[model samples]
Target: MDFPQQDPAHRTLTVVGGGVIGLTCALAAADAGWRVRVLDAGAGERASWVAGGMLGSLGEGIPGEEASLALSVDSVRRWPALVTRLDDPGVVTATDSLFVAASATDIEYLRHLADFVWADQPGTGAALQPVTGRDIRTLEPSLSSRLVGGYRAVGEWSVDNRRLLEALRATATTAGVELVSARVASLAELDDLGPDAQILLAAGLGTAALWPGADLHPAKGEILRLRRTRWSVPPPGHVVRARLHGRAVYLVPRADGVVVGATHYEAEGVADRVPQAGGVADLLADAIEVLPGLRTYELTEAAAGLRPCTADGLPLVARVDARTVVATGHGRNGIVLAPGTAERVLSILEGVEE
Candidate 1:
């Protein structure tokens, strides 16, 4: 299906949702000389706010995740150029990520993941090097002496999501992107708009609400922020993650604070809820086990956000109708996947065959 050629002089786009995904689309469209408006319900806490912002492509590798892996890598590749264009202070930060495994089972899984990436592309997985306990300690002296072994993914990076969102919002404003604080009840409301007007459904889980049966679900993730001074030992310069009993926890250190998270719960709905004490306790305990120094850190804040999940786990960036395009279901890698998704959306809108 081909969309009508939008007027080059004044293309108007209405994006639903103000989270990272929606904001990204709005910014990209606005930068392309489109008049964009973002509509967000602004009712509850969003996932973007609570994210740890780790841009881990290899670290998130799982079987049948090839599409996601490709999207992540492409997004990382575009960071340099994208950051330069944004002029945002917190656009991105290059930091290595460590994935540690304590038990034999988890060790095998980590190795398999590392091998999968390496097998697919030799140097692609160079960042993920098999390391021993001493090597881990040499890199991050603050780690607990209990660590057995792990892999260091070197080229990984993270973005301060709060700052990125702020920057995107600011850029959108500067580009004349209008932001409306209102929950979009349905996608039908955006139906059959004029040639100059385009409707983009970029609302995370809210996209599912608008188009019932849309392949989008919410994956609840809880995160905790810790004050930097609370730690007796200095925080790790790079993000640290450990896999225990098949579950994973990550400790991300930023300039302003350290974020430790997260717990994936499929049963939870997309409601705005303060992070549970139990969740924070679990994250703290995991962080301490990975790096004992974190035990001294004081909890500054706890929050929850629902990741937009899909059946295939790949983002949906397709035109659902003549005037409507849908982009959602980014899962845990929303920040990492935003650029690639935006590029695809633009391609489809421009009638480029994908």
Candidate 2:
């Protein structure tokens, strides 16, 4: 299924994969006046489908990973402009995120992490403010009263993943980009496009099969989507990330309810997309502990997604061959890194380096 191309005279670019990363790059390329055609197998259990959609540059940062942190901070900063361009302002569900601790041990760990972020990582466009349990409750009363203390990441944002994908597809279509519902098994399949035609491989985990050097692996994660009931407590206005008993859980708000997730593990031997019973149980337990009100909500969906991970924990966004550019291995930060990936891929495609 291919859409009609309105512009035949412009330079053509073919993008493989239709996930957030591929779609985002396609949209950016089309806006740059390229005749973009995206080829995707339309798989339902993709990484983008099961994501929590938190653009957590600050909240998700690690102390030693300075390079990846810088990339995350840079990418998240581009989301505001990208959201405006998509014309779907409602896709942004939360503008801030709060990291809370449910136990005393967790509180100490949270404080150390917060201190590192606040003192060492300065001017990253995100400010970390240490808040007590009372402050967290005042900010979001829906959370559990058992929370001890945590940090409020004033700049983190969350989006409706499904909605964002739809908006990107719609806007890209309107921008004259073609969406083809077919998969390219390998780069050799696209050799007929000739030497000068540009080809971008943004196929998420599938990029490894197309290009042997993508060095991508699948990190499977399970997420639950809960629907709010009439009797349920009002959802938190800010994205809530809770640390309980040495485990981390987050509840991202939706218009209808909340998204609870996710437990990560290696997916090499496990090929199933079914949400593991143990994982789901753990997520539910942690979520209910963080926001006790979630017990009443209906579990509308439970599934697993395979996030494309790399050895170094950084996304691969470089040109591989003369006409081929690879953009995958985004790990868990694909949604957060889409804009920055698009920016860098476009620069590479246009032969411009920064």
Candidate 3:
């Protein structure tokens, strides 16, 4: 994949999809002096719009997802660099994340996770501390009394995805990447842009519609945004992912509100677009069961978004051809992986192994 350098003023890169990944890629390509334009479907709803913005790779990992976990760990490392490059200090939260276990089964499951990560990843194991139920209560008094033990991935951070989108929009505009609204039903139709246009198909789930064999599907997840009174005891100061009765739920706190999510519903045979009542109900129940104070929080918003995923959860960031590249299937880690995905696309453009 050795792509020769083309003069920025002469080469055009049209990215299909205005989500986090597409916008980030536009910014990076603009920085490299390539003429860039982003085409979005103009639909307001998208996976990036509703992501919980958790940067907790250590907490999200499971046994068979080790390969994707490794990719995530690498992406997490690139967050600070992106923040610096974007020169937006307020985009990401400084608060760390906590993996909490609210019952005996949770404790055992978390213990297994701890053992796996500690043995599987020697580099970052020492910093991941095993926490007792008392330690958890001590750190966040709002936690339920029935909690068992969990572990803490110290220094892991979450982003305000809404703010990150704004920041990226501002940065991309400032970098001179043209933002346009266009629904690309056909990849070949984009050739109207120019003869040398490099079409980057970074269109989340929309990629599947453009190609019959595209290895991508949508996973619908429902999340609730709860608001607290300024005077109320604040929710957990950090991200808390709990495994209660074999179900996993996470509560991500932000200045605007606490993000309680998420219930995953896999679309079996066809695309399921709408939010399910059962999914929302389960997330709310699980979230409240772990932290009692959330019961009093105002239910500000309930929304569902579809995450583009591959069967194995690995992102597709390979060259479709010399002039086309596909980047999607990031699943739940799209926010955390956007910077690294941008890096990967740039590498492909430069004809390097991504």
Best by TM-score: 2
Predicted candidate 2 versus true structure: per-residue lDDT over 115-229, tens digit per residue: 6753565574346778898999899988878998888888789999999999999999999999999978778889898555789899988888888998877898999999999
Per-candidate clashes come to: 1, 0, 2
Candidate 3 residues lying further than 4 Å off, grouped into runs, are 1-5, 268-271
Candidate 3 per-residue lDDT over residues 200-290, each given as its tens digit: 8888888888865668777878888999876566867878888898899998878866898887767653346566889888988998888
Clashes in model 3: which pairs?
A: 1-351, 3-351
Q: What is the lDDT of residue 57 in candidate 2?
A: 81
Error of 2 at 341 (Å): 0.4
Best candidate, lDDT:
2
Q: Which residue pairs clash in candidate 2?
A: none
Q: Rank the candidates by TM-score, best first.
A: 2, 3, 1
lDDT of 1 by residue, 165-219 (tens): 8887887798889998987676667656565688888888878878775677787
Displacement of residue 52 (Cα, Å) in model 3 is 0.6
lDDT of 1 at 71: 78
**Local accuracy by lDDT, each model:** 0.79, 0.87, 0.82
What value does the lDDT take at residue 193 in candidate 2? 86
